[model samples]
Target: MVVMMSPFKGQTGFKRILNATGYSLAGLRAAFTGEAAFRQLLLINLVLVPLAFFLDVSRVERALMVAVCVLALIVELLNSAVEAAIDRISLELHPLSKNAKDMGSAAQFTALCLIGLVWAIILLG
Candidate 1:
């Protein structure tokens, strides 16, 4: 028996960076193309990043807000990727695919909740 490896396996540092960039771009494109919620979230970020500067927030609070927003975007991107992969595999409904998609959605929801919590604490405290 012979073991076969993937053709695209073992990426170097530059390749890793390129792959990440590709994924990020793909996620952004998918968000813009397919997900209205992601678009809304992005618009909210656009407002909040500048608002952070205007507010009398401490450096740490600003950092936290930035981190939370970035995390939310990252998670949403990952969720979009997962969904795309699942759909690519099959458009037909499957329990495992549903589970995977649901889990990805849950991850995004968790990230959104964290972002909300961070903003609430920083702005309201």
Candidate 2:
């Protein structure tokens, strides 16, 4: 069977990197503009990541602190993407659709909680 490729798929080497970076930046912009939760988490990260750098913690602690926040942001992006995909499939209510969206939301919540736990343990310990 023949396979179709993405618009950016055929490029190689430096061109591929440029295309990929453009796509990534576009995704980030879309997330910031379209997803309110993502925008809020990004604002939180803007504060937390800088604080992580200036804290008295060890390098590992700083890294972990920053990483957990980034993880939450990443998870939120995935959650938004999932919600968009499900909505694309149909706007009508369905148990499976509810389950998929709920699970995506749960994943984002877990990641956010993990970020909180990491920050509290590192900053308060």
Candidate 3:
């Protein structure tokens, strides 16, 4: 029997972890420079995270507030990656591609909503 390996999956162990970290950083750079939505969400985070620290909320509430902000950024990163992957596959308009992109957008939207809901409850309740 014969098996095939992905050329991109060559790294292993500690070296793989280092390479993965570098790749993740590069992806973050790319998203920061190229993706407007990511930048917007990051700006929002910059405001919300620090505000969380200053607020009179309990430690857990502050953490929850900051966590939701981070969650939104994570979701935006994922959504951008999905859009980039779909574009890399092909620019042609197709239903599957449209659906994939739309779903990614929806996920980001939901994350943003979660951020708002969590913050409101923690701040106002």
In order of lDDT, best first, we have 3, 2, 1
TM-score of each: 0.79, 0.89, 0.93
lDDT (Cα, 0-100) at 121 in candidate 1: 94
Alpha-carbon local distance difference test for all models: 0.87, 0.94, 0.95
Give the clash total for candidate 3. Answer: 0
Each candidate structure's count of clashing pairs: 0, 0, 0
For model 2, the local distance difference test gives 0.94
Worst 10 residues of 3 by lDDT: 116-125
lDDT, candidate 1, equals 0.87
Residue 68 error for model 2, in Å?
0.4
Q: How well is each residue in 1-125 modelled by candidate 3, as lDDT tens digits? A: 88999999999999999999999999999999999999999999999999999999999999999999999999999999999999999999999999999999999999999999999998789
lDDT of 1 by residue, 1-125 (tens): 99898887778799889998997787688788898778888887898778878889999999898888888877887788889899999999999999999999899899889988998998899
User: Arrange candidates by TM-score, highest first: which order?
Assistant: 3, 2, 1
| TM accuracy, model 1 | 0.79
| Candidate 2 per-residue C-alpha lDDT over 1-125 given as tens digits, one digit per residue, 9 for 90 to 100 | 99888875789999989989999999899999999999999999999999999999999999999999999999998999999999999999999999999999999989989988998998888
Model 3 residue runs over 4 Å out of place are 1-4
